[model samples]
Target: MSDGDPADDIMTATYRALCTHGYADLTMQDIADESSKSKAALHYHYDSKHDLLCAFLEYLYDRFVERTSDPAGADPAAQLRSLVQTVLDKPEDDREAFETAVLEIRAQAPYEPGFRERLTRFDDYLAGEFERLLEAGIDDGVVDPAVDPADTATFLVTMLTGAATERVTAGRSVECTRRMLAEYVESHLLTDATEAQL
Candidate 1:
Protein backbone atom coordinates (compact mmCIF):
# COMPACT_ATOMS: atom_id res chain seq x y z
CA MET A 1 0.00 0.00 0.00
CA SER A 2 1.15 3.50 -0.84
CA ASP A 3 1.41 6.30 1.69
CA GLY A 4 -1.74 8.26 2.65
CA ASP A 5 -3.95 5.48 1.31
CA PRO A 6 -6.46 3.51 3.39
CA ALA A 7 -4.13 0.51 3.59
CA ASP A 8 -1.29 2.73 4.72
CA ASP A 9 -3.55 4.18 7.37
CA ILE A 10 -4.34 0.69 8.57
CA MET A 11 -0.64 -0.13 8.80
CA THR A 12 0.06 3.03 10.72
CA ALA A 13 -2.79 2.27 13.06
CA THR A 14 -1.48 -1.25 13.49
CA TYR A 15 1.93 0.10 14.46
CA ARG A 16 0.44 2.44 17.04
CA ALA A 17 -1.80 -0.24 18.45
CA LEU A 18 1.04 -2.74 18.60
CA CYS A 19 3.24 -0.26 20.37
CA THR A 20 0.50 0.53 22.86
CA HIS A 21 -1.13 -2.84 23.41
CA GLY A 22 1.67 -5.17 22.25
CA TYR A 23 1.26 -8.28 20.06
CA ALA A 24 -0.63 -10.46 22.50
CA ASP A 25 -3.12 -7.82 23.61
CA LEU A 26 -3.49 -6.02 20.29
CA THR A 27 -7.00 -6.10 18.80
CA MET A 28 -8.67 -4.88 15.63
CA GLN A 29 -10.68 -2.44 17.75
CA ASP A 30 -7.48 -1.07 19.28
CA ILE A 31 -5.92 -0.64 15.85
CA ALA A 32 -9.07 1.08 14.54
CA ASP A 33 -9.06 3.36 17.56
CA GLU A 34 -5.69 4.68 16.47
CA SER A 35 -6.94 5.42 12.96
CA SER A 36 -9.97 7.25 11.56
CA LYS A 37 -11.33 3.88 10.50
CA SER A 38 -13.76 1.70 12.42
CA LYS A 39 -13.37 -1.94 13.43
CA ALA A 40 -15.66 -2.92 10.54
CA ALA A 41 -13.44 -1.04 8.14
CA LEU A 42 -10.41 -2.83 9.49
CA HIS A 43 -12.13 -6.16 8.98
CA TYR A 44 -13.05 -5.14 5.45
CA HIS A 45 -9.39 -4.75 4.67
CA TYR A 46 -8.13 -7.68 6.76
CA ASP A 47 -10.22 -10.80 7.22
CA SER A 48 -8.68 -11.47 10.63
CA LYS A 49 -6.19 -10.15 13.14
CA HIS A 50 -3.63 -12.68 11.90
CA ASP A 51 -3.85 -11.33 8.37
CA LEU A 52 -3.60 -7.75 9.56
CA LEU A 53 -0.54 -8.49 11.68
CA CYS A 54 1.14 -10.26 8.77
CA ALA A 55 0.52 -7.17 6.70
CA PHE A 56 1.89 -5.06 9.50
CA LEU A 57 5.06 -7.19 9.50
CA GLU A 58 5.46 -6.48 5.81
CA TYR A 59 4.95 -2.78 6.45
CA LEU A 60 7.64 -2.80 9.14
CA TYR A 61 10.07 -4.60 6.81
CA ASP A 62 9.41 -2.10 4.06
CA ARG A 63 9.93 0.80 6.43
CA PHE A 64 13.20 -0.70 7.65
CA VAL A 65 14.49 -1.06 4.10
CA GLU A 66 13.48 2.49 3.29
CA ARG A 67 15.07 3.77 6.48
CA THR A 68 18.45 2.13 5.86
CA SER A 69 18.54 2.16 2.05
CA ASP A 70 21.08 4.96 2.27
CA PRO A 71 23.94 4.68 4.68
CA ALA A 72 25.00 8.22 5.64
CA GLY A 73 28.74 8.58 6.26
CA ALA A 74 31.98 9.36 4.46
CA ASP A 75 33.74 6.13 5.40
CA PRO A 76 32.86 2.51 6.10
CA ALA A 77 33.25 2.80 9.86
CA ALA A 78 31.04 5.85 10.04
CA GLN A 79 28.50 4.25 7.74
CA LEU A 80 28.42 1.11 9.87
CA ARG A 81 27.90 3.22 12.98
CA SER A 82 25.07 5.09 11.35
CA LEU A 83 23.34 1.89 10.27
CA VAL A 84 23.53 0.44 13.78
CA GLN A 85 22.25 3.67 15.27
CA THR A 86 19.27 3.66 12.98
CA VAL A 87 18.32 0.22 14.30
CA LEU A 88 18.83 1.00 17.99
CA ASP A 89 17.48 4.52 18.13
CA LYS A 90 14.51 4.60 20.45
CA PRO A 91 11.14 5.85 19.30
CA GLU A 92 10.05 9.21 20.72
CA ASP A 93 6.93 7.66 22.20
CA ASP A 94 6.43 4.27 23.81
CA ARG A 95 10.11 3.50 23.45
CA GLU A 96 10.26 0.56 25.82
CA ALA A 97 6.84 -0.71 24.94
CA PHE A 98 7.66 -0.63 21.25
CA GLU A 99 10.83 -2.67 21.79
CA THR A 100 8.95 -5.11 23.97
CA ALA A 101 6.35 -5.55 21.29
CA VAL A 102 9.04 -6.19 18.69
CA LEU A 103 10.57 -8.82 20.93
CA GLU A 104 7.18 -10.43 21.38
CA ILE A 105 6.69 -10.62 17.64
CA ARG A 106 10.17 -12.05 17.13
CA ALA A 107 9.44 -14.74 19.71
CA GLN A 108 6.60 -15.95 17.52
CA ALA A 109 8.78 -16.29 14.44
CA PRO A 110 9.74 -19.93 14.97
CA TYR A 111 6.14 -21.11 15.24
CA GLU A 112 4.87 -18.97 12.36
CA PRO A 113 6.45 -19.60 8.95
CA GLY A 114 5.23 -16.29 7.53
CA PHE A 115 6.71 -14.39 10.45
CA ARG A 116 9.91 -16.43 10.24
CA GLU A 117 10.26 -15.73 6.55
CA ARG A 118 9.74 -11.99 6.91
CA LEU A 119 12.09 -11.76 9.88
CA THR A 120 14.76 -13.75 8.04
CA ARG A 121 14.47 -11.30 5.17
CA PHE A 122 15.19 -8.47 7.53
CA ASP A 123 18.34 -10.17 8.82
CA ASP A 124 19.49 -11.08 5.33
CA TYR A 125 19.03 -7.53 4.16
CA LEU A 126 21.06 -6.14 7.03
CA ALA A 127 23.76 -8.76 6.56
CA GLY A 128 24.01 -7.95 2.88
CA GLU A 129 24.43 -4.28 3.68
CA PHE A 130 27.13 -5.11 6.17
CA GLU A 131 28.88 -7.30 3.65
CA ARG A 132 28.93 -4.52 1.11
CA LEU A 133 30.35 -2.04 3.57
CA LEU A 134 33.02 -4.45 4.73
CA GLU A 135 34.03 -5.22 1.17
CA ALA A 136 34.27 -1.54 0.34
CA GLY A 137 36.33 -0.85 3.43
CA ILE A 138 38.78 -3.61 2.57
CA ASP A 139 39.15 -2.31 -0.95
CA ASP A 140 39.86 1.12 0.39
CA GLY A 141 42.42 -0.21 2.89
CA VAL A 142 40.32 1.02 5.76
CA VAL A 143 39.37 -2.46 6.92
CA ASP A 144 41.56 -5.48 7.60
CA PRO A 145 41.89 -7.55 4.46
CA ALA A 146 41.96 -10.70 6.55
CA VAL A 147 38.42 -10.06 7.72
CA ASP A 148 35.94 -12.26 5.90
CA PRO A 149 33.09 -10.09 4.74
CA ALA A 150 30.47 -12.82 4.99
CA ASP A 151 31.50 -14.04 8.44
CA THR A 152 31.95 -10.53 9.78
CA ALA A 153 28.59 -9.50 8.45
CA THR A 154 26.95 -12.43 10.14
CA PHE A 155 28.68 -11.60 13.43
CA LEU A 156 27.61 -7.99 13.21
CA VAL A 157 24.00 -8.82 12.46
CA THR A 158 23.86 -11.34 15.29
CA MET A 159 25.41 -8.85 17.70
CA LEU A 160 22.98 -6.14 16.71
CA THR A 161 19.96 -8.42 17.03
CA GLY A 162 21.12 -9.50 20.46
CA ALA A 163 21.64 -5.93 21.54
CA ALA A 164 18.13 -4.99 20.50
CA THR A 165 16.66 -7.99 22.29
CA GLU A 166 18.71 -7.40 25.44
CA ARG A 167 17.51 -3.86 25.89
CA VAL A 168 14.00 -5.06 26.68
CA THR A 169 14.59 -8.56 28.07
CA ALA A 170 17.52 -7.98 30.38
CA GLY A 171 17.66 -4.24 31.06
CA ARG A 172 20.92 -3.97 29.13
CA SER A 173 22.09 -0.48 28.23
CA VAL A 174 22.03 0.19 24.52
CA GLU A 175 24.74 2.79 24.96
CA CYS A 176 26.97 0.13 26.44
CA THR A 177 26.26 -2.14 23.52
CA ARG A 178 27.05 0.67 21.10
CA ARG A 179 30.41 1.16 22.72
CA MET A 180 31.09 -2.54 22.51
CA LEU A 181 30.27 -2.54 18.81
CA ALA A 182 32.56 0.41 18.28
CA GLU A 183 35.28 -1.51 19.99
CA TYR A 184 34.64 -4.47 17.74
CA VAL A 185 35.04 -2.26 14.70
CA GLU A 186 38.25 -0.73 15.89
CA SER A 187 39.86 -3.90 17.16
CA HIS A 188 38.74 -6.36 14.53
CA LEU A 189 37.44 -4.76 11.36
CA LEU A 190 39.82 -1.86 10.89
CA THR A 191 43.25 -2.03 9.38
CA ASP A 192 46.26 -1.24 11.55
CA ALA A 193 46.51 2.28 10.15
CA THR A 194 42.82 2.94 10.70
CA GLU A 195 42.96 1.47 14.18
CA ALA A 196 45.97 3.65 14.98
CA GLN A 197 44.09 6.69 13.74
CA LEU A 198 41.21 5.94 16.10
Candidate 2:
Protein backbone atom coordinates (compact mmCIF):
# COMPACT_ATOMS: atom_id res chain seq x y z
CA MET A 1 0.00 0.00 0.00
CA SER A 2 0.99 3.67 0.00
CA ASP A 3 2.45 4.95 3.31
CA GLY A 4 -1.00 4.74 5.00
CA ASP A 5 -2.67 1.73 6.57
CA PRO A 6 -3.14 -1.04 4.00
CA ALA A 7 -6.37 -2.29 5.53
CA ASP A 8 -8.04 1.10 5.28
CA ASP A 9 -6.85 1.45 1.70
CA ILE A 10 -8.21 -2.01 0.89
CA MET A 11 -11.59 -1.26 2.44
CA THR A 12 -11.90 1.93 0.41
CA ALA A 13 -10.99 -0.01 -2.69
CA THR A 14 -13.52 -2.68 -1.86
CA TYR A 15 -16.22 -0.03 -1.58
CA ARG A 16 -15.32 1.40 -4.98
CA ALA A 17 -15.17 -2.01 -6.58
CA LEU A 18 -18.51 -2.96 -5.11
CA CYS A 19 -20.05 0.19 -6.47
CA THR A 20 -18.62 -0.41 -9.93
CA HIS A 21 -19.13 -4.15 -10.34
CA GLY A 22 -21.75 -4.97 -7.67
CA TYR A 23 -21.52 -8.00 -5.43
CA ALA A 24 -22.79 -10.64 -7.85
CA ASP A 25 -20.20 -9.81 -10.52
CA LEU A 26 -17.36 -8.62 -8.29
CA THR A 27 -13.94 -10.25 -8.31
CA MET A 28 -10.71 -9.97 -6.38
CA GLN A 29 -9.05 -8.45 -9.43
CA ASP A 30 -11.63 -5.67 -9.42
CA ILE A 31 -10.72 -4.79 -5.87
CA ALA A 32 -7.00 -5.02 -6.69
CA ASP A 33 -7.47 -2.70 -9.66
CA GLU A 34 -9.24 -0.16 -7.48
CA SER A 35 -6.64 -0.44 -4.72
CA SER A 36 -3.67 -0.46 -7.13
CA LYS A 37 -2.57 -3.58 -5.33
CA SER A 38 -1.87 -6.96 -6.90
CA LYS A 39 -4.32 -9.83 -6.67
CA ALA A 40 -1.79 -11.65 -4.51
CA ALA A 41 -1.83 -8.76 -2.09
CA LEU A 42 -5.60 -8.98 -1.86
CA HIS A 43 -5.38 -12.70 -1.24
CA TYR A 44 -2.71 -12.14 1.34
CA HIS A 45 -5.20 -10.17 3.36
CA TYR A 46 -8.24 -12.32 2.51
CA ASP A 47 -8.34 -15.99 1.63
CA SER A 48 -11.08 -15.57 -0.98
CA LYS A 49 -13.65 -13.17 -2.36
CA HIS A 50 -16.24 -14.49 0.12
CA ASP A 51 -13.92 -13.89 3.03
CA LEU A 52 -13.05 -10.43 1.83
CA LEU A 53 -16.71 -9.51 1.40
CA CYS A 54 -17.54 -10.86 4.85
CA ALA A 55 -14.89 -8.59 6.30
CA PHE A 56 -16.18 -5.76 4.15
CA LEU A 57 -19.68 -6.21 5.62
CA GLU A 58 -18.23 -5.83 9.11
CA TYR A 59 -16.31 -2.76 8.01
CA LEU A 60 -19.47 -1.27 6.48
CA TYR A 61 -21.38 -1.82 9.75
CA ASP A 62 -18.62 -0.12 11.73
CA ARG A 63 -18.72 2.86 9.41
CA PHE A 64 -22.50 2.97 9.65
CA VAL A 65 -22.26 3.06 13.44
CA GLU A 66 -19.62 5.80 13.34
CA ARG A 67 -21.74 7.92 11.04
CA THR A 68 -25.02 7.44 12.92
CA SER A 69 -24.34 6.57 16.55
CA ASP A 70 -24.03 10.19 17.65
CA PRO A 71 -27.20 12.04 18.57
CA ALA A 72 -27.54 14.92 16.18
CA GLY A 73 -30.42 16.72 17.91
CA ALA A 74 -31.18 17.78 21.49
CA ASP A 75 -34.72 16.41 21.53
CA PRO A 76 -35.67 12.77 21.04
CA ALA A 77 -38.14 13.64 18.27
CA ALA A 78 -35.48 15.58 16.38
CA GLN A 79 -32.99 12.78 16.91
CA LEU A 80 -35.44 10.26 15.47
CA ARG A 81 -35.90 12.37 12.38
CA SER A 82 -32.15 12.79 12.02
CA LEU A 83 -31.58 9.04 12.28
CA VAL A 84 -34.16 8.18 9.64
CA GLN A 85 -32.89 10.87 7.31
CA THR A 86 -29.37 9.57 7.65
CA VAL A 87 -30.54 6.08 6.74
CA LEU A 88 -32.27 7.35 3.60
CA ASP A 89 -29.65 9.84 2.46
CA LYS A 90 -27.20 8.78 -0.26
CA PRO A 91 -24.44 10.46 -2.21
CA GLU A 92 -25.86 11.43 -5.60
CA ASP A 93 -23.06 10.12 -7.78
CA ASP A 94 -22.89 6.44 -6.76
CA ARG A 95 -26.22 6.13 -5.00
CA GLU A 96 -27.82 3.68 -7.42
CA ALA A 97 -24.79 1.47 -7.88
CA PHE A 98 -23.91 1.35 -4.22
CA GLU A 99 -27.47 0.63 -3.15
CA THR A 100 -27.72 -2.09 -5.80
CA ALA A 101 -24.53 -3.67 -4.54
CA VAL A 102 -25.80 -3.68 -0.96
CA LEU A 103 -29.11 -5.18 -2.10
CA GLU A 104 -27.25 -7.94 -3.90
CA ILE A 105 -25.34 -8.71 -0.74
CA ARG A 106 -28.51 -8.70 1.32
CA ALA A 107 -30.10 -11.08 -1.17
CA GLN A 108 -27.24 -13.48 -0.72
CA ALA A 109 -27.68 -13.41 3.03
CA PRO A 110 -30.42 -15.99 2.83
CA TYR A 111 -27.99 -18.56 1.50
CA GLU A 112 -24.77 -17.37 3.06
CA PRO A 113 -24.35 -17.80 6.78
CA GLY A 114 -21.52 -15.29 6.94
CA PHE A 115 -23.61 -12.61 5.27
CA ARG A 116 -26.70 -13.48 7.31
CA GLU A 117 -24.76 -13.12 10.55
CA ARG A 118 -23.26 -9.75 9.59
CA LEU A 119 -26.53 -8.38 8.25
CA THR A 120 -28.40 -9.55 11.34
CA ARG A 121 -25.99 -7.55 13.42
CA PHE A 122 -27.00 -4.42 11.51
CA ASP A 123 -30.71 -5.05 12.14
CA ASP A 124 -30.20 -5.80 15.82
CA TYR A 125 -28.06 -2.74 16.41
CA LEU A 126 -30.46 -0.43 14.58
CA ALA A 127 -33.44 -1.85 16.49
CA GLY A 128 -31.63 -1.26 19.74
CA GLU A 129 -30.89 2.32 18.80
CA PHE A 130 -34.50 2.92 17.86
CA GLU A 131 -35.68 1.43 21.12
CA ARG A 132 -33.28 3.60 23.09
CA LEU A 133 -34.58 6.73 21.35
CA LEU A 134 -38.22 5.79 21.94
CA GLU A 135 -37.58 5.10 25.61
CA ALA A 136 -35.79 8.41 25.97
CA GLY A 137 -38.64 10.23 24.28
CA ILE A 138 -41.19 8.66 26.58
CA ASP A 139 -39.13 9.51 29.66
CA ASP A 140 -38.87 13.12 28.47
CA GLY A 141 -42.64 13.31 27.85
CA VAL A 142 -42.18 13.80 24.11
CA VAL A 143 -43.34 10.37 22.95
CA ASP A 144 -46.70 8.78 23.71
CA PRO A 145 -46.44 6.73 26.84
CA ALA A 146 -48.61 4.05 25.27
CA VAL A 147 -46.00 3.35 22.59
CA ASP A 148 -44.11 0.13 23.21
CA PRO A 149 -40.47 0.88 22.51
CA ALA A 150 -39.54 -2.66 21.51
CA ASP A 151 -42.43 -3.11 19.11
CA THR A 152 -42.07 0.37 17.67
CA ALA A 153 -38.35 -0.14 17.20
CA THR A 154 -38.93 -3.34 15.30
CA PHE A 155 -41.56 -1.70 13.13
CA LEU A 156 -39.29 1.25 12.35
CA VAL A 157 -36.35 -0.97 11.47
CA THR A 158 -38.52 -3.11 9.23
CA MET A 159 -39.89 -0.03 7.53
CA LEU A 160 -36.39 1.26 6.88
CA THR A 161 -35.20 -2.04 5.46
CA GLY A 162 -38.23 -2.18 3.18
CA ALA A 163 -37.57 1.33 1.94
CA ALA A 164 -33.98 0.52 1.10
CA THR A 165 -34.88 -2.67 -0.69
CA GLU A 166 -37.73 -1.12 -2.62
CA ARG A 167 -35.49 1.67 -3.83
CA VAL A 168 -33.16 -0.78 -5.54
CA THR A 169 -35.56 -3.52 -6.60
CA ALA A 170 -38.49 -1.46 -7.81
CA GLY A 171 -36.83 1.88 -8.60
CA ARG A 172 -39.01 3.37 -5.86
CA SER A 173 -38.31 6.83 -4.47
CA VAL A 174 -37.40 6.85 -0.80
CA GLU A 175 -38.74 10.35 -0.28
CA CYS A 176 -42.28 9.00 -0.14
CA THR A 177 -41.31 6.53 2.53
CA ARG A 178 -39.50 9.26 4.39
CA ARG A 179 -42.62 11.40 4.45
CA MET A 180 -44.72 8.46 5.59
CA LEU A 181 -42.27 7.81 8.42
CA ALA A 182 -42.38 11.44 9.47
CA GLU A 183 -46.16 11.38 9.46
CA TYR A 184 -46.13 8.20 11.49
CA VAL A 185 -43.90 9.87 14.05
CA GLU A 186 -46.12 12.90 14.26
CA SER A 187 -49.39 11.02 14.47
CA HIS A 188 -48.55 7.75 16.19
CA LEU A 189 -45.48 8.10 18.35
CA LEU A 190 -45.29 11.69 19.53
CA THR A 191 -47.36 13.12 22.36
CA ASP A 192 -49.88 15.80 21.33
CA ALA A 193 -47.72 18.49 22.92
CA THR A 194 -44.59 17.14 21.27
CA GLU A 195 -46.35 17.09 17.90
CA ALA A 196 -47.27 20.72 18.37
CA GLN A 197 -43.61 21.61 19.01
CA LEU A 198 -42.53 19.79 15.84
Candidate 3:
Protein backbone atom coordinates (compact mmCIF):
# COMPACT_ATOMS: atom_id res chain seq x y z
CA MET A 1 0.00 0.00 0.00
CA SER A 2 2.91 2.29 0.73
CA ASP A 3 4.65 3.02 -2.54
CA GLY A 4 7.32 5.71 -2.26
CA ASP A 5 5.07 7.76 0.02
CA PRO A 6 3.33 9.47 -2.92
CA ALA A 7 0.56 10.86 -0.74
CA ASP A 8 1.95 14.38 -0.94
CA ASP A 9 2.02 14.34 -4.72
CA ILE A 10 -1.43 12.85 -4.84
CA MET A 11 -2.90 15.49 -2.54
CA THR A 12 -1.28 18.33 -4.46
CA ALA A 13 -2.65 17.01 -7.74
CA THR A 14 -6.04 16.48 -6.18
CA TYR A 15 -6.09 20.06 -4.97
CA ARG A 16 -5.21 21.44 -8.37
CA ALA A 17 -7.81 19.30 -10.09
CA LEU A 18 -10.45 20.16 -7.50
CA CYS A 19 -9.70 23.82 -8.03
CA THR A 20 -10.05 23.31 -11.75
CA HIS A 21 -13.07 20.97 -11.83
CA GLY A 22 -14.71 21.79 -8.49
CA TYR A 23 -15.73 19.44 -5.66
CA ALA A 24 -19.14 18.42 -6.97
CA ASP A 25 -17.65 17.27 -10.25
CA LEU A 26 -14.39 15.93 -8.88
CA THR A 27 -14.02 12.18 -8.50
CA MET A 28 -11.52 9.86 -6.92
CA GLN A 29 -10.79 8.37 -10.31
CA ASP A 30 -10.03 11.82 -11.64
CA ILE A 31 -7.73 12.44 -8.73
CA ALA A 32 -5.95 9.12 -9.24
CA ASP A 33 -5.43 9.85 -12.92
CA GLU A 34 -4.21 13.37 -12.21
CA SER A 35 -1.78 12.14 -9.60
CA SER A 36 -0.47 9.26 -11.73
CA LYS A 37 -1.58 6.79 -9.11
CA SER A 38 -4.02 3.92 -9.26
CA LYS A 39 -7.45 4.30 -7.71
CA ALA A 40 -6.57 1.77 -5.05
CA ALA A 41 -3.42 3.64 -4.23
CA LEU A 42 -5.32 6.89 -3.86
CA HIS A 43 -7.79 5.22 -1.57
CA TYR A 44 -4.98 3.81 0.51
CA HIS A 45 -4.05 7.34 1.53
CA TYR A 46 -7.58 8.82 1.59
CA ASP A 47 -10.44 6.49 2.34
CA SER A 48 -13.07 8.65 0.63
CA LYS A 49 -13.74 11.87 -1.19
CA HIS A 50 -14.85 13.41 2.09
CA ASP A 51 -11.51 12.58 3.67
CA LEU A 52 -9.67 14.07 0.72
CA LEU A 53 -11.68 17.25 0.90
CA CYS A 54 -10.93 17.63 4.60
CA ALA A 55 -7.23 17.10 3.91
CA PHE A 56 -7.37 19.71 1.18
CA LEU A 57 -8.85 22.22 3.58
CA GLU A 58 -6.06 21.51 6.02
CA TYR A 59 -3.54 22.02 3.25
CA LEU A 60 -5.05 25.35 2.29
CA TYR A 61 -5.07 26.46 5.91
CA ASP A 62 -1.40 25.59 6.27
CA ARG A 63 -0.53 27.48 3.12
CA PHE A 64 -2.46 30.51 4.26
CA VAL A 65 -0.70 30.53 7.60
CA GLU A 66 2.72 30.19 6.00
CA ARG A 67 2.07 33.03 3.62
CA THR A 68 0.66 35.47 6.18
CA SER A 69 3.45 35.53 8.77
CA ASP A 70 3.85 38.79 10.66
CA PRO A 71 6.42 41.19 9.32
CA ALA A 72 8.87 42.29 11.95
CA GLY A 73 8.98 45.96 12.93
CA ALA A 74 6.03 46.86 10.69
CA ASP A 75 3.66 49.48 12.01
CA PRO A 76 0.30 48.26 13.35
CA ALA A 77 -1.70 50.03 10.66
CA ALA A 78 0.65 48.77 8.00
CA GLN A 79 0.42 45.21 9.34
CA LEU A 80 -3.34 45.38 9.38
CA ARG A 81 -3.37 46.68 5.82
CA SER A 82 -1.09 43.87 4.74
CA LEU A 83 -3.42 41.29 6.24
CA VAL A 84 -6.45 42.77 4.48
CA GLN A 85 -4.58 42.99 1.20
CA THR A 86 -3.52 39.36 1.45
CA VAL A 87 -7.10 38.20 1.83
CA LEU A 88 -8.17 40.30 -1.15
CA ASP A 89 -5.24 39.16 -3.24
CA LYS A 90 -6.22 35.47 -3.21
CA PRO A 91 -6.22 34.21 -6.80
CA GLU A 92 -9.64 34.22 -8.39
CA ASP A 93 -9.39 30.69 -9.67
CA ASP A 94 -8.41 29.39 -6.26
CA ARG A 95 -10.97 31.64 -4.58
CA GLU A 96 -13.90 29.82 -6.14
CA ALA A 97 -12.59 26.40 -5.14
CA PHE A 98 -11.72 27.55 -1.64
CA GLU A 99 -15.14 29.10 -1.11
CA THR A 100 -16.84 26.02 -2.49
CA ALA A 101 -14.89 23.78 -0.15
CA VAL A 102 -15.80 25.90 2.88
CA LEU A 103 -19.49 26.06 2.04
CA GLU A 104 -19.65 22.37 1.26
CA ILE A 105 -18.23 21.34 4.60
CA ARG A 106 -19.95 24.02 6.67
CA ALA A 107 -23.14 22.01 6.94
CA GLN A 108 -21.26 18.91 8.01
CA ALA A 109 -19.09 20.80 10.49
CA PRO A 110 -21.56 20.34 13.31
CA TYR A 111 -21.57 16.59 12.77
CA GLU A 112 -17.82 16.37 12.30
CA PRO A 113 -16.16 17.55 15.49
CA GLY A 114 -12.71 17.71 13.89
CA PHE A 115 -13.97 20.03 11.17
CA ARG A 116 -15.63 22.28 13.72
CA GLU A 117 -12.54 22.39 15.89
CA ARG A 118 -10.18 23.13 13.01
CA LEU A 119 -12.44 25.91 11.79
CA THR A 120 -12.44 27.44 15.22
CA ARG A 121 -8.65 27.30 15.35
CA PHE A 122 -8.34 28.97 11.97
CA ASP A 123 -10.80 31.69 12.92
CA ASP A 124 -9.09 32.29 16.22
CA TYR A 125 -5.72 32.56 14.50
CA LEU A 126 -7.05 35.24 12.17
CA ALA A 127 -8.79 37.17 14.95
CA GLY A 128 -5.77 37.00 17.20
CA GLU A 129 -3.47 38.42 14.54
CA PHE A 130 -5.86 41.26 13.83
CA GLU A 131 -6.20 41.96 17.54
CA ARG A 132 -2.45 42.10 17.93
CA LEU A 133 -2.20 44.67 15.17
CA LEU A 134 -5.02 46.71 16.63
CA GLU A 135 -3.39 46.72 20.06
CA ALA A 136 -0.11 47.82 18.53
CA GLY A 137 -1.86 50.62 16.66
CA ILE A 138 -3.46 51.82 19.86
CA ASP A 139 -0.13 51.76 21.64
CA ASP A 140 1.54 53.69 18.80
CA GLY A 141 -1.24 56.26 18.68
CA VAL A 142 -2.23 55.11 15.18
CA VAL A 143 -5.64 54.06 16.48
CA ASP A 144 -8.00 55.89 18.80
CA PRO A 145 -7.51 55.20 22.49
CA ALA A 146 -11.23 54.89 22.90
CA VAL A 147 -11.54 52.07 20.38
CA ASP A 148 -11.71 48.52 21.68
CA PRO A 149 -8.90 46.62 19.99
CA ALA A 150 -10.63 43.24 20.22
CA ASP A 151 -13.92 44.52 18.83
CA THR A 152 -12.31 46.57 16.08
CA ALA A 153 -10.05 43.69 15.04
CA THR A 154 -12.95 41.25 14.92
CA PHE A 155 -15.02 43.72 12.93
CA LEU A 156 -12.27 44.44 10.42
CA VAL A 157 -11.58 40.75 9.80
CA THR A 158 -15.27 39.99 9.47
CA MET A 159 -15.71 42.84 7.01
CA LEU A 160 -12.76 41.68 4.92
CA THR A 161 -14.01 38.10 4.91
CA GLY A 162 -17.43 39.21 3.76
CA ALA A 163 -15.93 41.30 0.99
CA ALA A 164 -13.73 38.42 -0.14
CA THR A 165 -16.65 36.03 -0.12
CA GLU A 166 -18.63 38.43 -2.28
CA ARG A 167 -15.74 38.80 -4.68
CA VAL A 168 -15.50 35.02 -4.97
CA THR A 169 -19.22 34.36 -5.33
CA ALA A 170 -20.49 37.36 -7.32
CA GLY A 171 -17.71 37.41 -9.89
CA ARG A 172 -17.00 40.96 -8.85
CA SER A 173 -13.73 42.54 -9.87
CA VAL A 174 -11.06 41.93 -7.22
CA GLU A 175 -9.47 45.28 -7.90
CA CYS A 176 -12.70 47.08 -7.23
CA THR A 177 -13.27 45.13 -4.05
CA ARG A 178 -9.73 45.77 -2.90
CA ARG A 179 -10.08 49.49 -3.38
CA MET A 180 -13.44 49.53 -1.65
CA LEU A 181 -12.11 47.58 1.33
CA ALA A 182 -9.04 49.73 1.68
CA GLU A 183 -11.11 52.87 1.56
CA TYR A 184 -13.48 51.35 4.10
CA VAL A 185 -10.72 50.63 6.61
CA GLU A 186 -9.12 54.00 6.14
CA SER A 187 -12.35 55.86 6.68
CA HIS A 188 -13.82 53.76 9.45
CA LEU A 189 -10.93 52.33 11.41
CA LEU A 190 -8.58 55.27 11.23
CA THR A 191 -9.83 58.04 13.48
CA ASP A 192 -9.22 61.75 12.96
CA ALA A 193 -6.46 61.58 15.52
CA THR A 194 -4.82 58.64 13.82
CA GLU A 195 -5.07 60.29 10.43
CA ALA A 196 -3.55 63.46 11.84
CA GLN A 197 -0.67 61.46 13.30
CA LEU A 198 -0.10 59.77 9.97
How do these models rank on lDDT, best leading?
2, 1, 3
Candidate 1 ranges beyond 4 A from true positions:
1-3, 91-94, 192-198
Off by over 4 Å in 3: 1-5, 71-73, 92-113, 175-177, 191-198
Backbone clash numbers for all candidates listed: 0, 0, 0
Q: What lDDT score is found at residue 13 in candidate 3? A: 74
- Considering every candidate listed, which one attains the maximal TM-score? 2
Q: lDDT for model 2, on a 0 to 1 scale? A: 0.86
**lDDT tens digits, residue span 30-147, model 1:** 9999998999988998899888888888888887898887778888877776787777676344368777887898999989887888889999999999999999989988888999
Output the TM-score of candidate 2. Answer: 0.91
Better of 1 and 3 by TM-score: 1
Report the number of backbone clashes for model 2.
Answer: 0
Write candidate 2's Cα lDDT for 104-133 as tens digits.
Answer: 999999999999999999999999998999
Query: Which candidate number has the best lDDT?
Result: 2
Residue-by-residue lDDT tens digits, candidate 3, 1-198: 123556667767776666667766788987877787888987888889878767766876776787676734357777777777776676444647756656556556788876777766666778888888878888887766777878877776677667755665776666776776677657766553233111
